[model samples]
Target: MADKPMLDDTEDVALDFGAEDELDRQRRFRHPVAVFFHLAFRVASILVYLLCGWFVDSFITSFVLIVILLSMDFWTVKNISGRLLVGLRWWNYVDEDGKSNWVYESRKGKLKGLTTAAESRIFWLSLVVCQVIWLVFFFGTLFTLKFKWFMVVIVGSLLNGANLYGYIRCKMGSRKKMTGVATNFLGAQVWRSMLATATASAAGKE
Candidate 1:
């Protein structure tokens, strides 16, 4: 009897992670257009920063261009890509306490599922690889005392971190909600069993 709750919890988790009806999962991935733009702009940002230094001899112009690209990449990924790909969104806020906080939001719907597990895997992998390469560049600049390159690295890191945080928070929130559902189900079952026992006892005495 003690094991029943455990079994129920396990079953609930399984349902939470269950594969949906194939027909439902098909013909969609939330927003395909947004995903394309997300990847396109991400690549463009990196290329623009690298090319700006390589092809443009004017340091000030290159810096300005790279900064703009970084901002665009950050906005697109946070506001569009994250939501479309994982049904998650995050933003920053300042409260009366004058402290900065990051607010994360996610939806719980079958429609909230990622287009495909592979898509998310590839997308996140790409971000990790890109960030690692930038980190390598960052260290190289640090050792060389190349402040010019360092500035670009800083911007890249901030953008990459934002995307990473959004995806992770989304995943975690989903898991938390699923676990809560399982717990609630278990509690309701116990309550009903107790209620049934009391009703039967009263009827026997009548």
Candidate 2:
């Protein structure tokens, strides 16, 4: 008898078949489910922070809950949601020299050719809006002089800032790549023109 397929492998294959034409693979922003959860998680994180601080009236519990939710949101957005929504992914790692380096990867080929206007608009707008909201929350905490809440806001803001930086860097990389292509195209055109001129000069001499 043939060996049976592993349940895990079967499940994976089934899921792949279900989403065979994943929009992200086409570099299109068509993930209603992912986008829904992405926004839901972000909104829920802040709501929970507020609930713990105001309604529950427990400093320790509030602080812990806020930190955990924020952490989850950070990971989900950075890894899963960003990739699904924008076709961009980023990570940072420390080298043997103890220097940290960030890597930004973007989908290329036909997926890249599909373009990024819609994704970029949503991605950048979300970042800006999140930063602004977090900043407002930071000031609100400051008014209350709650050191713990302030700390939470600071951490959340830093995470948002880092995301913004990574995305901007990724976009810059795309721009540089495009610029290189344009330069090469112009150079080839110039070369072709030079060849034609030389050919004409030779014909005249002949």
Candidate 3:
């Protein structure tokens, strides 16, 4: 009788471990869809910024131009993921059995699965702030006297570096890591102001 109980308990433990392994497999094989969006957004932002600088002779206001560009860039991504995906699919996680699961099954994980309204807003706002800063620095250099090409080159390099660092960090490290040292070195004051403004707006609305 004692042996029988011990054998049953061992079998239960093995079954539980198997289920956990399956969950881990699912996580490791996370869909590449989100990553695709990330790359597409970055590439498109860079191209748009370059094109705007090349053309648009009437947009003398750096602030206005930056605001419009950043707003469109940020809000578009946020809406695409949060509003469109969430509304269309209601964005649920399902087990192998096709049963609904929580947004995050466990706290220790990467906090993955489904963009909530709050998360979407922050993502939108943060990217906007970052892009605005880069744009402001770029325009400020363009408008500066002495016309030092070196300065613009330096700032652009720094911005790209920060973006690269941030990208790598997000891919290899945690989602919340602040690896954007280049942005700190070359980004303009507008970025800070915009971040503060966005935070206030989000807080007030909430």
Candidate 4:
């Protein structure tokens, strides 16, 4: 018999299927424009709220500017950024019965591929942090006796808080949907298996 060659146990071997690279790319910010605007509006609102008093002489001008920025941020995040970056959207409507309802929607099936982990992190982190910042501003305004800025802080809090709450509900709704789907699938599979077993036992008895 021929002598067998010795194997090199010290060599490092790795299996690269390119899957990791693809996942890493998917986790990056694929939509630069969307990411830019997503951060831009929120940062602008915060900056205007904080520094407007120093630049603008009139309180009315500062208030109006902050409100405008807040409104713009709210609209952009609620309508545009949320949908584009996180594949989530939410809106409220009044029905014919004089009842209010909030609708939360997430991209399903193939549409979910449009979202990235980086974008989602940016969207949610900014949303939550902005709310906390506004809350701090709220208390600071109250304690400092800056009643004029209190209204501005309130507006900021409401607008940012609404988005935070809406997104939280949207996330919870998505989880519930997924859970229901999995439960239904498992139930169906169990029923099918039981039916198969029953049919097999009946055939054997015959």
Candidate 5:
């Protein structure tokens, strides 16, 4: 009798099909909030780098210390669960209504896949590379005193502008395809966005 085809009456339909799973995944996604936070932090980081450039008393020591702190914080996020920072625009997927959503990536990825740790490592590596550049610039300024911190400021400004434009556009129902913009800067994955949208919408109102 095919084992009587027994049904588990206690389980909610949504729970059975994994709506909770998708929500859990979406919670990990990154969005504009993450970008804003990074932008703010990077500004402070750049200032520290420039300060390092201006003063030579403890250049290397300061740089190393800062790097260590930043790396540790990033690694914590990379390893921890539920406490990861899911920024506004860092790792986002698009919804059908075309709104952008975010996740914490590596830590979040672990919930869904086998290579979560590897992905987290990669994410951390990228962050480390950026932080290293940050420290080097500061250290250089301290030793040489001839560095142009303005350039860093300008580039950061431009990146922030682009980020703002892209994030706002995505939110506003802009019919314009966000291909070149999000792709080049935000690591935008349209397919993932579509999947996120479908899943989110289907799970809603049901």
Candidate 6:
């Protein structure tokens, strides 16, 4: 008889890791609308700043347009995108005693699981990249002695930097909170184990 086939008979299998990963990533962004706007405003601001001079002659007009786009990007990222995409938000307030306090919040309960890794990566990457781009613009202005555009770069830097800072703080706070909870749980377990051992020893000696 002819030798048996070396492998079990099965249907042809395709191993396209890249295509699988791309499909999985697309599925992870549960909120497509949020993702779209999160990227749209940020891209718009950067593009407008870079290309405005070619289309618009007036410096004042370019400045106003850029500022407006930056403002919109900042607001959308802080208010809508942060909450919907990453489940994080932060703000500062001053009390009557004149002490300023920063508040960081993360999603809790069942809703906490709604945030996907893909969405979070997109949110934070966009935030950090935009901030870095603005910094480059700032130094470009300084080195080239473009004083008129300095103010615009400064505004962009400040806005993007604030969001990046706030989100970073928020992320740290969440990590600390989780660490505390885990510590308390372990401490309780250890205490109970010790107490049970002491009780058993005392009873046995009686």
Residue lDDT tens for model 6, 71-130: 988898889999999889998899999999989887888787677788989999999899
Score each candidate by Cα lDDT.
0.75, 0.76, 0.46, 0.89, 0.46, 0.89
> Rank by TM-score, descending?
4, 6, 1, 2, 3, 5
lDDT of 3 by residue, 1-206 (tens): 46554454443333588777656654442334643463355455555545655666544453345444444444444335333322211124689999986331111233444334434344445445555656665666677752543343344445444443433333344333344555564576668888999999999999
- For each candidate, give its TM-score against the true structure: 0.64, 0.63, 0.29, 0.74, 0.26, 0.70
lDDT of 5: 0.46
Model 1, residue pairs in steric clash:
none
Query: What digit string (tens of lDDT, one per residue) describes model 1 on residues 134-178?
Result: 788789889999887788888888778767867677668768789
Q: Give the TM-score of candidate 3.
A: 0.29
Maximum-TM-score candidate: 4
* Clash count for each candidate, listed in order shown: 0, 0, 0, 0, 18, 0
Per-residue lDDT over 81-164 for candidate 5, one digit per residue giving the tens place of the 0 to 100 score: 112332112235799999987542222245334223333343335455554564465466567764544344334334434433
Compute the lDDT of residue 12 as modeled in candidate 3.
38
lDDT of 4 by residue, 110-172 (tens): 889788888899999999899999999999988999897888999999999999989888878
Best by lDDT: 6
> How many backbone overlaps does candidate 5 show?
18
Number of clashing pairs, model 4?
0
lDDT of 1 at 26: 49
Residue 149 error, candidate 3, Å: 14
